[model samples]
Target chain A: MQWSTLIVFLLLFVLVTVLGFVAAHWRKADLNQLHEWGLGGRRFGTWVTWFLLGGDVYTAYTFIAVPALVFGAGALGFFAVPYTIIAYPIVFAVLPRLWYVAHKHNYVTGADFVRGRYDSPLLGLLVAITGILATMPYIALQLVGMEVVISALGFPMSGWAADLPLLTAFVILAAFTYTSGLRAPALIAIIKDSLVYITVIATVVIIPMQLGGFGKIFAAVPPAKVLLAAPVGQSLGMYSAFATLALGSALALFIYPHVLTGVLSAKNARTLTRNMAFLPAYTLVLGLLALLGFMALAAGVDKVPQYAPFFKQYANSFAVPALLMHSFPGWFVGVGFAAIVIGALVPAAIMSIAASNLWTRSIYRAYINPRCTEAQEASQAKLASLVVKFGALVFVLALPATYAIQFQLLGGIWIIQILPALVFGLYTRWFHRYALALGWLAGMTAGTAIAAHLKFAGSIYPLHVFGYAIPGYAALYSLILNIAVAAALTVLLRLLGVAGGQDQTTPGDYRAAVPDRDSGAGDGQMAAPPTL
Target chain B: MTTRQSSSGIHPRLWWRLLLLVPIIATLWVPWYNHLNPTFIGIPFLYWYLLMWVPLSAVCSAVVYFKTRDLV
Candidate 1:
């Protein structure tokens, strides 16, 4: 192990661990309440929400994988930039309504909203279970990211000894999350984002200058890697793939349990909307980070003797780490590596908290113990978060990293299946509850079948529409089928005179205004209704 | 609560909010900006063009947010 780098990394790791535990008292709330622990009492203002959401969305795995994808596959990997950019406008238009309604009802998970909206406890359970399934591998993938950085620090790579450090890191993570809940990640996200900004800025400036300039960097990349190949025929080959990936990912990004948890934790709808306006700042940084793949290619990191062993082990995933080790000093390498490892902890913490919220609110309370007290519910969530993190830890240690990635691919496909029931339900309750569930089943089945047909090798499926091949994201394709099924069945169910479930929310809930400053109506408390 | 405001329709005052869709449509139509020339600071046209939209999209959302602040 490199002593200086390991020392610096350990120092920062210890710092964040302390921050995580200390965050429980940061906001000074009763930790026994579910909302206080799971949603930070819904009290995060614009800046805190900005940092929290940024850290939550742009994950550590994303930091490693996006550039790795770009390094390997070229312009197609740049879809992340447009995906993040497109996400905000959609968030601006849709999520404030969700935020407003969630605040009014104290809904903690998307499934809670779905359950309340359709008056279907079964549907709520489905959403909750689907969320948990999708998130577990996602949490595991964060471990894979941490593994990359940890192993890059010259730790053990295999055997029981290798997993010891990961296990220790996670035990500490579980402890802080259990003690502090969402506050830990929200507090730690601030430092994570600051370090990320410094790392990205320093890398962009120093690396480009060292390698001659941006001109030389682009010149070093192969011609095919510089721009997307134009569609030769009616196929719309990579073009459609790029566009649909951007669109489908944007649509699915905010719907994830972790992202929605970030949204629901905001102080009010206005905070969410204002954040939508500014959150694209992360997208800008993400775009520049994607270009670093080209820089790594230019620098010939794979050819370097010192990093060749890592490149052989990790392939493209080692690009960023190798670049850092090759370029930065040992101490600054510690800071950058610490930034990435802390980045993993923030999202892993949030995802577990979100999954546990899904369990305690929608499944446990909704099914097992209807009369559980608020304190009991909060305790249940704390324990459930620990269980969720442990399950992910086992998933990473017992299985290959490829298995986590495959499951994560399926996770995206499965999570987006709920969009028809969740997102559409936000605007209107025209869909029959049973029909929505059926659509979810069809989408999940179809998405899984398509991915399996492709041997789970990729997310894009080539569709022959009237013999014209159009390859696009499997999520969007299945989502189309989902909407079609939901609409057709809704009409059929309406014709059969079947009852659509009652919506527990009202129109005013979607547009609830903040109370006047002196009114003593708290952050999530309903204001006096304005006359229509 | 009154049922006068229907869920299906956007209020006329909030029509400006549709401007938010501009970025979504523009970015998703990949063929529009999938070129290599007109490079900015040696970054390819496709790369810099999409990056430019990052900030521009924020401005679009910001405009929509300020416009609809009082309404919602």
Candidate 2:
């Protein structure tokens, strides 16, 4: 055990814990309101939104897993780079509209927007349940990321003692999150992102210097691992998988509850669009981080006696940690590991907060107590955040980590099903609410069944059509099926002269900016509805 | 519904938003840049090409953002 590493890790952990509590007072708002606690009162400017969204999307598990994937499977793993790159443009196009309408109507969650848009509480409930279900495993995976780092730091790994440090970290996380709400993650995200940038930059620069250079690094890697496999007879093979995975994941990224929480917390619609223009900076960092897998191969860390055992245990997931320990000294290892652990905490806090918002607004207030006051809703969300964190804790501790992974895979598949209701509902009210709900149901069942058929071993399914084999992400395939069903049902329902649900939002709401900022007071005035 | 006409009218600069699709199409067309030839700094073409789009895509979005800033 390296005492220097442990000491620095603990020091950074304590510092963030203090910052977490202090964040409750950062913006100095009335925490009794749901928007205040859950959305940081929608006052984050461009920079804060950038860090928060970066911290939310580029998760600790992603830091560990992306490199691990590159380390194991080679070029196919680099799909993440294009996924993030394309994601920003899509965000630029789609999310500002969501932010505008959400801000205008006081919509705290995507389900709130759906509820308001479709005028159907049942559809809202479906979105709420799906968001919560998709998010739980995600929070659990953050725990897995934390577990990897803590175990790397030489913490206990067996019996009850194994989970104690994780438990303590989470308890502290839950306390700060419960007290400070979304502000905690938003504020801590700044520090977390700074540390991650330092670690990644230092690693890319220093590690390559140690290992000769990039040319040698690429040269050391096997030819097969250097580039994606070419297409084979009838099948587009890894090429199709890589493209679809990138596209599907790009679509799915912003739709996650945690990501939307970050987006909606922006001060205004312009802040969100401006952020979309710059968030690709994180994608660049992610691309560099993915290359570390090849660096690990070039360095041949698996051949080292000490790291071989970890490699045996974790397989590819241990690539980043093993590479760090091999490349850096004991003190820097602490900083790098802290960056990853803090990375886990930021997303976990935001995700739990997002889930609780869904529960409180869409479920509790909607049905459990229709007339619950503002303070009551806020307090319920606080409690629900604790419950969500505790559930993730138990999910990680009781079950094998593989279960968390499988569920997370299914989570991505399931979460994308809500895109039709949320993203489509943003533009036209043409889709029947019932049709959207039924489409969601169909997508959910088929996605789950396909994932189960693959035994959750992989997310790519070989879809055969017209004598050609196209293997792509299960999420995208199911989403296509989802949209087709919704469109077909919408036409049938329209033919029967069924009434589409009422849309509370006007087109003006989608273009609504902050009241005092933009030039046209007239445009803003049309969207103002007395702030609910 | 009257307000819809005033607000939802297409922005004159909205055509600039088409620029956002450049990166999407470029990156999604995998076969175009899939080769290992013309390596930069010993990095494979496939690797650096995608990374290049990371910044280029941001530029595209930023250009569109500036052009259509008034829309939001």
Candidate 3:
């Protein structure tokens, strides 16, 4: 093992852990509350919010996978770049309204919003279940990236040594997250984003020069592997899969529980709006990372060393890690690897918190006990967060690696189904509560089935649906079907005199700035919390 | 409700719309795009992808900025 590289890596890891623990005292707030532990006191300003959301949206997977795909497949991998660019405009128009409504009602999760909007606990339960299901695997995918990089550095894991790395990463993650809440990841995200920026910029310049310049690298790629290439008898449906994936992914970005957690944590709608407007800048880095895919292909880097099982190559996926180790100096490589490893922890921590909040507020509180105290709920949530992280680790360990990648994509699909309840419900409560439930069911069922068919099919079908080769990405098609079913059911239910339930807040609620308008007190709620 | 329009934004809009052209041009650098002769600038089209992405991203992001800025 490269001890110099290993030394640098350990230093970064220790630094991030220290930041995680210190983040608790950084806010110096009441650590006993759910808002403090889970949502970071629900008070991040635009700068921290930008880094937090940016770090969340651009995961270690984006750093690892996008370029890996580009390296393997060619032009198709660039789709993630455009999807991110377009995502902000969509979020800008929708999320502020959500923040307002959720804030006015003191809602903790999307399930809370859905439950109140449509007056249906059942619908809220479905949203909660889907959120927990989606987030668990998505969090695990972050660990997969960390495990890949850690294993690549040849970290020896016999019993606890092997398990200790992941266990340690998660425990440090949980400790800071448990102690500081949302602030933990927000603080560490500063390190994650800086390391990522430095590494990507350095590699963008360094790798091409090392490999005989731009001309020689492209010249090395075989014609068959270009945009039109297929592995042996494979066809060109991959392009369709790529396009559908971009579309589905963009639509899904805003609905994830983690995305909503970031939005709701903001100080105000203006902050959320401003951040969305500027967030696309991060995609420039993503585009650079995606290009590494092509670079890896050009460099002839494939097949991870046997000792490093997690570092194996697939186009657009493994490109960044492979190319960095292949091309960069050892110290810089250590920094880049730390960025990916730490990057994984930031999202993993937040995602677990988001999922845990759903378990606490929506599932346990609603179903198990109606009179649950806020302290009880907060305790349950903290425990749930730990369990969810470990559960995700187990899933990541049990599933085949490729299947795990598909699970994150599946996470995107499941989360997007909540759009009508969260995004659309922000605008109008016209859809009957029963209709929302029906739509969610239809979308989940159809999307999962289509995705299954795409994954399992033996030969050519009319259209590939949802990365499954039926027609389109299952997420896109099922979403359309879901929306249509939702609209149709809403009309039918309303026509039959089904009430949409009690909307506790009115149209004015979507524009409300304060938790309680009657006081008009000079509370510091609107002002940014001092940076810790 | 009001719609706001500004000319400063228009130039960025055009730049954004036109930015697509740079990648198309850069696509020529990768060898994969070279069906006719299979070479440009002595670098295959794939190698040029990294180069093209840096500039292309600038244009795409500029468009995003123009589209979302507080012009109103």
Candidate 4:
């Protein structure tokens, strides 16, 4: 597939579709509104909120499943490089107090700051239906990392460039996310993190100097395929499933909902707390893309065709186009597959504008119309971000890219069961919004029946907990039994008093952030509270 | 809560005392107590984890730029 790496991957996909329709006139403003079509108008800074939160937490299934679980297990996929170096000191001690309580209460989703910090429109409709069912399989695993780089450029898989490249990359990612909402994926995540830090520090120094360095690629790999090996189910169950997948993915990386719509589209709160203390310099480029799974298990370079149930024969899903066709030159594998196809179009346009800002502010203005306006909630969040990019292009044409990589590690274990109703209703009002909606329907029905019995147990190939035995990383231990059954049914329905509602935010509205006192807008100013 | 601004320029504080050089270099490059005196500079003991994660990741990104450089 080399026509000069397909003319440098179609001239970097026509220079990222003319920088995604000139990022709707690069957030000049007045794009008819949902805070400038779902959050970019909050206006970013701190280096475009550090390349939009380092291209929304270094994705493309972390450049293909943490080097396919450290090339099929050894030193446990460097537990997502020490849980992204202890998730930037746990998002610099709790995300600038959740971006100073979602910019002093003008809260736009994290279920509008848990329905105004526990006043409760049914816990902001269960944190906007656990953020559109954990962000439609994390935007259908960014179209299964652009269908593993269009199934390693062979493409074919019968007709129309494999049944229309995810419906023409979701109709040019829903026409520049309906004309640059979230500034067309934060200005194409500064050319998708400068082509993923120039293709992960040029494939960890040109594939260990074309294989024979780093002690002859760790003496032709195999220490029964390292992630730190020696049958603790091959390296302590991949170092306790990448140290509980880097401390439950750095404490559910900014409690999802498109990373709180890229930390409330930053600009202030100290450029969202100095881009969460310089996002661990993109976890040192995701620990050099998890050491390109030991340079694709020491350059065997199969690039998939090895499945014996360590989630089917791994080469860490084409560990960066099999370490750019085993170390560059083939015209730098079209500038490393145009930096993994603009790292699967900057988290498929910020998970379809954080799932069309949860169907235009929690289901069309909570239950289809409480007199909808702001230009009809910015034209129903720009036609629900083109119907959430054609429902992630119908999960990239009806599933089976291994259930789109076990639906983004079970959408980070079902959106960390909406972290006790959005980070414990931003520091507690004492839960009970109908016992946090019956503890989010009993922790989303026991974390989807223990993640569908660890995805169809059948002699358990990649499943098992409470006797342990995991692989397709059982939705972070079924979200620790979905946050201990939503904090034990919110402390047994706040001690049987049968928790009533109507607190709609107080503790001085989490110390207000001044855009003319809680701009929920009904003109008269201070009238901002109410959700239920 | 405005008056807050903290990032004192070149910043770099203790940073969790660099987890005391990760168990003294993860017991000399994790093969868990390298099979009775293995190589170090000549490398083995799991190739001294690519020279111990580049100075424990530049001292954890310089202690997250010195505890959020006077966090604005």
Candidate 5:
């Protein structure tokens, strides 16, 4: 019971909560408007957008889980590196288009973009529903991250005592998010990123010195797991899973509503480009974070006194925290834990706002109350954000973390199904709307069914395709099925003379160097029906 | 939606198209280079080859962005 660690952790928590409350006033935008509340006025500058995005995409999960996976399975965890690497190039291409079009139309959610492109409320509803479902487990994973860190800090195990601390953290987090909206996460992100950078650098440099070097760290891991287990003449053993995991995650990364919320919050397309150029630095840091898994193995983290009992029973997710606690001094351990716990807040804040934005714009305003005013939409999103956060809370507190993680497993596969309708529509409005919907349905069903049927829960589910066995990353296999179904339906629908819906966006909208600089506040409804 | 082609303010779209292909090919099918002999600064071929793609892809995307940023 290191009191100093507890004291240090609480102090940092207090500081970030103050920052979260103060953030509502940071940008000084009109809280009464949905754009401002949900998107920070859609005007975050380069560094702020960088940090906000950095926070949104790199979750407490990265700090806790990446290394945990590496610690558990050795080389398999390194797939996160390739996933992020490929993701940014996609981000480089996708974000500017999304930002330009979203800004031009003042669209707040991806579903809003779909509705604008297709002029079909049902399609927009589908996108909104997928975005919301994808976000919930991700948010729950954040809670799981915080709980892991707190439990490492010597909180009571099991039962109500353990649940109380996580519940309290969420309640405080919910209050600030309800009040501050997007700005809360944007501001807190700076603090979170700095802490993570310092902690990762110090741990990587210091720990390797303590346990010889990379040579010894590799030596410590089993030789088979050290290099990915690619059997003779077959890459699918690990390579296929690795490639598919990276590709699937890269495709899915931008589609998450929270990631888009961060992107659309930026002031201009240039901000996204500049951010993309340097955001890879975080991926480099993530590489170091993955190495921490080896470091944890070197430190004999699973054998640590407090954690041995738990790890003996559960998965290796606690290895990273155990290593931090074992190696660092009490206060630094507090810093390490605090860094992760606060890291959770930033993404959790953005996720709820993103989910609520989908609710207000795509569902509530589009279907439930088409005549709702700007102020009404803002208020409705505020309430929806509350519900989104608590819904995640209910998921984390009531259900097993394994289920939350399993839900997130489908999240990658499930969310990518919407790529055709949302991303392709950015380039050309060619695919028939019904075909796109059916594609999403097929992708969702096939991806979920395949990933679920395979027994390997949590992250890696072995997939069987044709004759080869793909050890993990079931999403990409299903993505192929998804695209095939959509492409076939599209051609068939076209031959049948099925007409597509009118697209709301114009040619100029896609290449707008500087979108009309709308004061974005109180922006009007759905772009005048496309003037066909 | 605009059946109009991106007019000529941008560099050859072909180059950007080819540039984007670099990462897809390099990363999409990664089994061939899956080995442990050529360790880059103490990391294995399996791990380092993939991580090297991070910066390589960034540079490629940078070229594409600068080339096509002003396309009309």
Candidate 6:
């Protein structure tokens, strides 16, 4: 029954639990302050920021689902690599500026940055609400990642029975995240990244060897599935769809409030720059993980004796785990499963903290209690993190685990709509605040409607206009209309003399670096604005 | 309520900003490289084409990062 494997996983889980709790005191900041609790005092050094961000961004289901796509469909799954490739350079272009302005204004969340930049509370609230909605489902999907591993561990229960153990695992995650905030995930990222390295390496090197070689693996895939040629005729969109999916997702990745939380928490601009330089190493790992799907196919996973029964019932999401369970001994199977489980927990911690920070900074303080102090903000965010995690739990329970994938897909599309008001607004304020909001509305509606119309979880939807399929990703198509609407409306609004609201940022603020002097950085720099 | 200013060498900013186009524009046209007839160690052109850009993107970001560090 693999009890020994279960015990090994439990031991590692216990070790990470201790680390999560101890992280509350890691940098020794006053935990009562919102910045400290919500952002690890926004002082993560280079390697810490690397691990924390590496852990936060490349999530758990991604560890499973990317490979699952390759296993099920073939080369199309490799889109994740190009998407990630463009992502770092994009980060290089704009995120440092975001960090600079966010730090200058003592803004703890992306919504707070939106509020300060556009000087519009309603725009900030829209960003905050969108961030919370996108992140909640995403957090729920992490549980789905963990849930797949738990069910794969020889427990074949379905429906409500499958979720009980997951609920328990999430409760422990919620407890530690509530107490420790970003620090918990920062410390746990170390363990998560280490195990991910071991898992990806094993799948990439060992499985290929065991299954003959990559030559034999590619040859084993049916010619149609493995061939890279884009089919001609009405499916011309397939070719461009591949490229645009990567570009669109790359644009969307860092805009997630959780991603911005990681970005904003770095000690300074250079840390972020260095992180972008090396974060591609994680992309390298992702490439290897994507190859694991091919490895699963080559290994003839459905034919493996141990996994044959489960193979008949489940989807390709279990391919890598099944490969591990089939190849490695039970204890290593436990270690691999533990890696996936820990991977989910790390992001769940960071995302709840990021989401709750949005709730506290942009929603609660702006609406519920305008007079809230620093300590109150921290406590409110702490309490809100639990609520966010609880919401994630309910989301996971209400939607079938299968539908959980739809939520994850929707997150990328939903979060990208905020770019005009949130990201482009970083570089130029040419976009009027209302025009930005309208852009967000058009983009969100188009993106969500297209995704929902397909009623499928994967990215390929033939965008047929007048019965002719167009070549593009859903987000890219929406982004086209998003910018068009924002630009045209911006010119129209400016002509009518609509006030663009106050810009609380200065041009110099974008280029200012944190001082080399370490004293009183981050904690004492916050100056409350009179206008808000 | 204070403003800080530092002049950038227009040279480095211009260079790095231009460097960003290496990945973004290179990947924009996918059909150019979407062939598998020329495989690399059993990897298709489609897969290796994208993987090739991963390191390139990193190099571009690293260069931009160093160039911009002086401003911040």
Index of the highest-lDDT prediction: 2
Candidate 1 ranges with C-alpha deviation above 4 Å: A394-408, A513-532, B1-10
Interface RMSD of 3: 11.6
lDDT of each: 0.85, 0.86, 0.71, 0.64, 0.79, 0.80
DockQ, per model, reads: 0.48, 0.51, 0.11, 0.03, 0.35, 0.43
Going through the candidates in order, what fraction of the true interface contacts does each contain? 0.64, 0.70, 0.09, 0.03, 0.39, 0.56
Clashing pairs in 2: none
**Candidate 3 per-residue C-alpha lDDT over A1-532 given as tens digits, one digit per residue, 9 for 90 to 100:** 4777788999999999899888888768876787777778888999989988998888866876566556655665666765675576567656776887788889989999889887889989999999988887788778877776776677664566876676777778878777677878899999989998888889878888888876676657665555533323333345445556666777887788888888888888778766754676687788767767767877766754632344432223455666777777788789999989988899988898888989998999999987987788888988888888888877676655542346577777788898888778887787778887888899998777765666622111235335444334667776787889999998998789866677776654665343333563422123322211
Better of 2 and 5 by TM-score: 2
**Residue lDDT tens for model 4, A79-198:** 666666565555544555676667766777788777766666766877787777677767767766776675555555556666576567667877887887788778888887887788
lDDT-best of 1 and 6: 1
Worst 10 residues of 5 chain B by lDDT: B1-10
Tens digits of per-residue lDDT, candidate 1, A80-124, equal 888999988888888888988888887888998999999999899
Per-structure clash totals for the candidates = 0, 0, 40, 19, 0, 0
State residue B25's C-alpha deviation in candidate 4, in Å.
36
Candidate 2 Cα deviation (angstroms), residue A276: 1.3
Once fitted onto the true fold, the runs of candidate 5 whose alpha carbons sit more than 4 angstroms away are A231-235, A312-314, A397-407, A455-466, A513-532, B1-14, B66-72
Q: lDDT, candidate 3, residue A282? A: 85
lDDT of 4 at A48: 81
lDDT for model 5, please. 0.79
Q: Give, for candidate 6 chain A, the lowest lDDT window spanning 10 residues.
A: A523-532
Q: What's the TM-score of chain A alone for every prediction?
A: 0.94, 0.94, 0.89, 0.39, 0.93, 0.92
Interface RMSD of 1: 5.8
Tell me the tens digit of each residue's lDDT in model 6 across A1-532: 4898889888999999999899888878888998888888888899999998888778875677778778887766677778878888888778888998888888888888889888899899999999988888788878777877888876656776766777778888988988888889998899888888887777677777887777888888887777444757666645667777788888888898888999998989878988988999998888888888887888788677767656554567678778788778888888899999999899988999999999999999999999998889899999989898888877766653333345566677778888888888887899999998898899889888887677536545667777677666787788878899999999999999999989997765776543532353422242332211
Which residue window of length 10 is worst by lDDT in model 2 chain A?
A523-532
Where does model 2 sit among the CAPRI classes?
Answer: medium
lDDT ranking of the models: 2, 1, 6, 5, 3, 4
Residues A361-465 of candidate 5: C-alpha lDDT, one tens digit per residue: 999998899999889999999999889887887656554443333545567877888899899988888788888888889888877777656532554566655
